[model samples]
Target chain A: MRNDGETIELIERLARLVTNEGHAHGLKPAQWEALRYLARANRFSRTPGGLTAYLGLTKGTVSQTLMSLERAGLVEKTANPGDARSVQLGLTEKGRALLPLDGMATIQKAFEALPQPLRATLGDGVAALVTSALAARSGRAFGICHDCRHFAADARGPGQHYCRLLKQPLEDAEAEQICQEQEAA
Target chain B: MRNDGETIELIERLARLVTNEGHAHGLKPAQWEALRYLARANRFSRTPGGLTAYLGLTKGTVSQTLMSLERAGLVEKTANPGDARSVQLGLTEKGRALLPLDGMATIQKAFEALPQPLRATLGDGVAALVTSALAARSGRAFGICHDCRHFAADARGPGQHYCRLLKQPLEDAEAEQICQEQEAA
Candidate 1:
C-alpha cells in the first residue's frame, strides 16, 4: 500500500505534467482539459452542463474554459435547440489536430528511460491498470468501448463486431452508442 | 510504444479516478493539489508569485485557489513583512488534521482490487513510473536531502558520507537543501 502522502504527491505531479503539456500548446490546465474532452467526444453534442459534470467543475468554470477554447479556435459553441439558456460545445478541426497525437511519443520516451527489466515485466494488464486508475481519478469510467480494440464493427462477430483493443466481447448496445473515449477524425 | 490514442484513453481514465478521489474529499482537483502541496512542504514561505511558479498556475488562478483554501479553513494567510502585496500561506490546524495519517490502507484496498502478481510488481518501480513520467513532463527534478537521511557531517574521506535516499555522496549545498521530489513528500 502506498502512503497518502505518496498518492497525493503522485497525483500532484501528474497534474503538473499535464499542465506542462497544455502549456506547450499554449493552453491552461482547465482549457486543456476542456479541449481534451471535446476532442474525445464522438458526436459533437456535448452540453456545457455535461462538460461541467464530466470535469467535476462548476458551470462558471466550464464556461470560462470554453471561452478560452473558443478563443484558441479549438472549440465551437452552438445554441442548444432544446434549451434557450444552455449551449452545446463541439471541437474544431484545429482541436482535432491538437489532441495529443504526440502523447505516445512522450510516453515512449518515458518508457525507454525506465530499466529494461521493468519495461519487460509490464504487460497489457499494467497498461490497463493505468487506464483504470486515470479513470478512477478523473471522475470517469475506464474499459469503455473506445478502449477496446475489439469494438470495431468491421471485425468478425454478429453485426460486424469484435473489440480488438480488449480482445474480448463487445456488447450490442455499445456498438451503436458513442463512448466518451472515442475521438472523431 | 503504445498507441497515442490508447495512452490518452488510459490517462483520461486515470484522471477520472483521481477526480473521484477529489470529489470524495469534497474538493476540486486544483484545491486538492493545493492541500497536498502544502502538506508535503517541509518549510513554508510567502508570495503568490512563488506559489504560482511552483504550481505552474496563473496569478489569477492561484489567487482564486488560495481564496477557496482559506475559506475552507484548510489554509491561513499572513502579512508578508517585506512584500505588502504578497502573503504567507500556511496550513491551518484543520488542514493538518485533515491529512490522512495511514493512507496505506486506501492503497491496500486499491491493491486488493488488482491481481496478486501485479501487486508484487509495483514494488519494483512500475508504480513509480507515473511519478517519473509526471516529473519529466513538467521538466522538474527532484532529489532527497542528505541530512534527513542521516549522512555524516564529518567525513574526511571522499564519497564516505553517502545519502541513503540518493545513494550517492552529497555536495555541500545538497546536504542542507531538499529537492522537488522530496517536496512532493
Candidate 2:
C-alpha cells in the first residue's frame, strides 16, 4: 500500500496540474475542458446533459460553465431542429479557432517528443488506467464511433459506418469523434 | 502520433474528472487539492507562495483559494515566528477529519484494485508523463525530501537526514513528504 500511495499521489499531482493549463488564456480550467469536449464530441453527444455526464460534474456547474462560454462567444446554444423542445450545443467559430492554441497542444508536443518505444508503452499504460478508472466510477467510456458496438458495416459508403443505435450514417471523420452513447465493441 | 493523441486525451479526461472529486463535499477540486498538498507538504512547502508554485497557478488564484479555505475554517494562516511578513498554513482538526472522506479516496481505491504488476507499470507510465509535463513547463520538480540532492545522511541520528538547502534536520516521516526545494539526489 505504501508504494501504491506514492503512485496515487503522482497521478493526483498531475491531475492538479492540468487544471492550470487554461490559466494563461484567461479561462477557467473547466471552461477550457468544456470547449475541448464540445469540439471533439459527436452530434448526438453535443448537448449540455451529455457534457454534464462527461465531466462528472453537477448540472449546475456544467450549465454555469456553458453560460460563461456563451457569454464569451466561444459556444452557442441552438434549438434542436428535429425536436422543438430539445437543445443542441455547438462551438462558435472562435471556439473552433482557439482549439489549436489550447494548452493541450503543449502537452501533446511533450508526448510527441518522447522516444517511439517509450511512447508506445506509455500509451498502453495510460489506456489501462483510463479503463480501470471508468470501470471503478461506473461511467460511460465515451469512445469513438468506430470503437462502439453499435457501429455497423452497412456498405453505406467508403470509410462510412452506420450507427445501429442512432440509425444514422457516420463518415470516417465522424467515426473518430467521441460519442456519449459509445459502448465498446 | 495517433496513439499518443489517444493517450494524451485519456490523461486529460481523467484530469477533468479529478476536478469533480471534491464536488460532493462542498469544496472546489482546487481547494481539495490545496488541502491535500498542504497536508503532505514539508514545513518549508506549506505557504501560499509555495502552493502557487506547486499548483502552477497564479498567486492571485492561490490567494483567493486560501481565503475561501480560511472562511470555511478548513485551513488556518498563522504568521511565521521567524518571519513576521511570511505566513504558514495548517489544516484544522476538522480539515484533517474530512480528508479521509475526500473524493480522492475513490480514485486511489481504483488504483489499489489493480493487479500488482499492472499497478507497477501504470505507476511508471504516470510518473513518466508527470516528469515530461513538468519538463515541458520548465517547472520545479516538487518532489519528496529523501530524493533531494540536499539530503545529507547525518551521522548525528538514526533515520534522520540533514537538508543542505534548509540547513535543518529531517525525520524519517518528514523525508517522505514533498518539499518545494527538493532537487534530485
Which one wins on DockQ?
2
Over all chains combined, what TM-score does candidate 2 have? 0.92
- lDDT, candidate 1, B79-181, per-residue tens: 8766687677778999888766333234334545667566456434435556467556464433234424345544647644545444456556555443443
Q: How many backbone clashes does candidate 2 have?
A: 0
Residue A159 CA displacement from its true place in model 1, Å: 9.5
Reference-based TM-score, model 1: 0.59
lDDT by residue for model 2 (B3-53), tens: 667888888987866666667588887888899998999889999999999
Give TM-score values for chain A, per-prediction: 0.57, 0.92
The TM-score values for the models, in the order shown, are: 0.59, 0.92
Native contacts recovered, each model? 0.18, 0.63
lDDT winner among the candidates?
2
Q: Per-residue CA lDDT of candidate 1, range A37-155, in tens?
A: 66554342267776776666678977888887788898998887757887777888998788665343454466567776676544343454553453444434323454444357656
